[model samples]
Target: MSTLEIKDLHVSIDTEQGTKEILKGVTLTIKTGETHAIMGPNGSGKSTLASTIAGHPRYNVTSGSILLDGEDVLEMGVDERARAGLFLAMQYPVEVPGVTMTNFLRTAKTAIDGEAPSLRHWTKDVKAAMENLKIDADFANRNVNEGFSGGEKKRVEILQMELFKPKFAVLDETDSGLDVDALKVVSDGVNRAAEQNEMGTLLITHYTRILRYIKPDFVHVFVDGRIAEQGGPELADQLEDEGYDRFLVKA
Candidate 1:
């Protein structure tokens, strides 16, 4: 099975004030077919961890190693990372003004696989995925995420995840702004990918609501740029009941 390993990662970003550390000595390992949920309060560096893994240039890896199947992930560029099977569903997906959803998906698929998918098969797969996510077929003709609602953008994100079939997916606050129905729909897509592709998931969220649908094999509590605590799925229940007040008190 594939493995994504983070070893004592320290990430920082330059701000108007100065360079500020976000992830301080964070380490975690995810294997294919495993789901790892990272729960924490706001400003706890959960999103930073996700961005770092996806090779966002804004977050500098001050000192650490990110390895995917023993290859140096940090050495790869952003597109290279995607080609390496690392995927990130951003908290706020951006709009590509001129790129239609159909073209974007096909282009990305071609880039990752190094060959364009068969037009007939690709069209069928895209149609099936959009229907499963309840996305309107008209969205195929629209520009990527252009003028889409928050919920719609999120659905499109999951749609990309489903089509890409990455080995690991870092969903940064994917549950944010999603209503109950949309949450279930998105969660179902994630679960489907895991079952079908054995995709390892790094789910970052503050609420345990998503956990109810997308069960995590492991739960990590991030506070002050480090993992303050971790446990099984039971830990998420505790967080929901007790909240991060206890962890914040310590931080």
Candidate 2:
């Protein structure tokens, strides 16, 4: 089984004020089919961890080791990491003005798999996935996330996740701004990906509502630049009842 390991990760980013350290000695391990939820307040370096794992240019890893299935992932570039079975669903998916969803998804799938999928099966698969996600058929013709609502853009991200079928998926605040219905749809899609594809999930969110649907195997409470606490699903319930106030104090 594929395993993604983060050991003593330290990351920083350059701001106008100067370099700011975000993640300080964070360590975690996620194996295929395991869903690990990272719960934390804002500015706690949760997204930073996701971006770092996905090889985002903004976050600089001063020291740490990110390994995927015993291979050194920190050394791989962004596209290289994706090809190595790493997927990141951003909190705010960007718009690609000229790229159609069909073209973009096919191109990305081709890149990750090292060969283009068969056109007939590919088209059928895309349609089936879109239907399962409750996305309209016309969505394939639209430019990538162009003029779409927040929920629509998020759904498209899940669409890619379903199609690409990565070994590890880092979902950054996928529950953000989604309504109950939309949230259920997206959450169901994530569950499908995890169960069917056996994708290792690092779900980063502040609220436990999403956890109610996704049901993480482990919960890690991130504070300041480190993990302040971690436990089973019950920990999420505690956070919902008690809140992050105590964790903030520790931070």
Candidate 3:
């Protein structure tokens, strides 16, 4: 089974004031077919953990380790991590002005798989995946997220997850700007990816509303850059009702 392990991870960034630590000591494990939801308030270092795992240059790993099936993830570069089956769906997906979605998707799939997919089969797969996400056919020809709405950008991210089929995916607050319908559609796409590929998922969010549609096998409450508590789905319900006041007080 595919596994991603984070052990006492500490990350920092160079701010205007100087270097500031973000992730204090985060340790977690996600195995194939297991979904882990990370819930916390703003500035709690949830995104730091995600970005660190994805090899964002901005975040410097001050200590600890990240392993993919016992392989040292910390040694891999950003693209190398992608090839190692690590995918990050950014909260704010950037626009690629000149690149069409079709070329971008195919190129990315090729890079991850190390071989070009059959054009005929690739086209068919893309069409079906887009249909499942309610993406229009014309989007394939459009510039990637050039002028797409917030919901549309989020949908495109999910589309990438479906097509690339990463071993582990870090969805950084995917539920941020989605409406109820958009949320459900995006959630369905995520569910499909996990179920079909047995892809391990690490879902980061501030609110518990998303847990309703994308039920997590594990729930971790992040506070002050560390996991304050962890439990089953019922923990999410408790957090929904009680909020993070207790955790904040402890922090």
Candidate 4:
């Protein structure tokens, strides 16, 4: 079974000043076919947790450990972690001026799958995934997010997730900066992927709109760089109504 475990994770980031801890004693685990939602305000360390899991060089795990399928993740580099079935979709995707979506996807697929697909099969797979997401065929040739809209960037991230089919995924703010139509398309693409695979999804977002489409099994509240609360889907409702005001008082 695919499983990701985070135990007492404390991530400190170095800046102009000294190091500052972003994730404080955070512990969580997700298994195949499970979806976990992480909700927090801006600067609550949600993105830091996602970046650290993906092996961002800037974030240091000062104390604690991360494991994927019982293997130490800290021992592996970013590429190694990806090869081991960990994927992270960023809140803001970077633009690569010369990289076409097709080229990027093909290269990533070959690396993640550990084998190159036949040309015809590769085209078919790519086309099928794009078609399901209603992405224009021309998007295949467009440079990776060079001038794409905010929604388009998020959709491209979902497309990558579909093509790579990682065992565990950390999606940071996948629903942010998206309009209603774009949100539906991106959400549909994500559901299409998660529905077909026994995916372990750790969806990090501020709002509940995306959750309406993906339906998380667990909702976690991140406050003061730690998990202040956790519960089933109903917890999302509570947060929407009660807000983090109570959490600030208790946390």
Best-fitting candidate, scored by lDDT: 1
Candidate 3 pairs with clashing backbones: none
- Where does model 1 exceed 4 Å of error? none
Displacement of the residue 179 alpha carbon in candidate 1, Å? 0.7
- Assess each prediction's global lDDT (C-alpha) against the native: 0.97, 0.95, 0.95, 0.90
Output the lDDT of residue 115, model 4.
Answer: 88
Per-model TM-score, in order, reads 0.99, 0.99, 0.99, 0.97
Between candidates 3 and 4, the one scoring higher on lDDT is 3
- Once fitted onto the true fold, the runs of candidate 4 whose alpha carbons sit more than 4 angstroms away are none
lDDT of 3 by residue, 1-251 (tens): 99999999988999999999888899999999999999988999999898889988889999999999999999999889999999999999999999999999999999999999999999999999999999999999999999999999999999999999999999999999999999999999999999999999999998888899999999999998899999999999998899999999999
**Which consecutive 10 residues in model 3 have the weakest lDDT in total?**
48-57
**Residue lDDT tens for model 1, 1-251:** 99999999999999999999999999999999999999999999999999899988899998999999999999999999999999999999999999999999999999999999999999999999999999999999999999999999999999999999999999999999999999999999999999999999999999999999999999999999999999999999999899999999999
Per-prediction CA RMSD (Å): 0.6, 0.7, 0.6, 1.0
With a 3 Å backbone cut-off (N, CA, C), the pairs that clash in candidate 2 are: none
Expressed as tens digits, the lDDT of each residue in 165-189 for candidate 2 is 9999999999999999999999999
How many clashes in candidate 1?
A: 0
Error of 1 at 56 (Å): 1.0
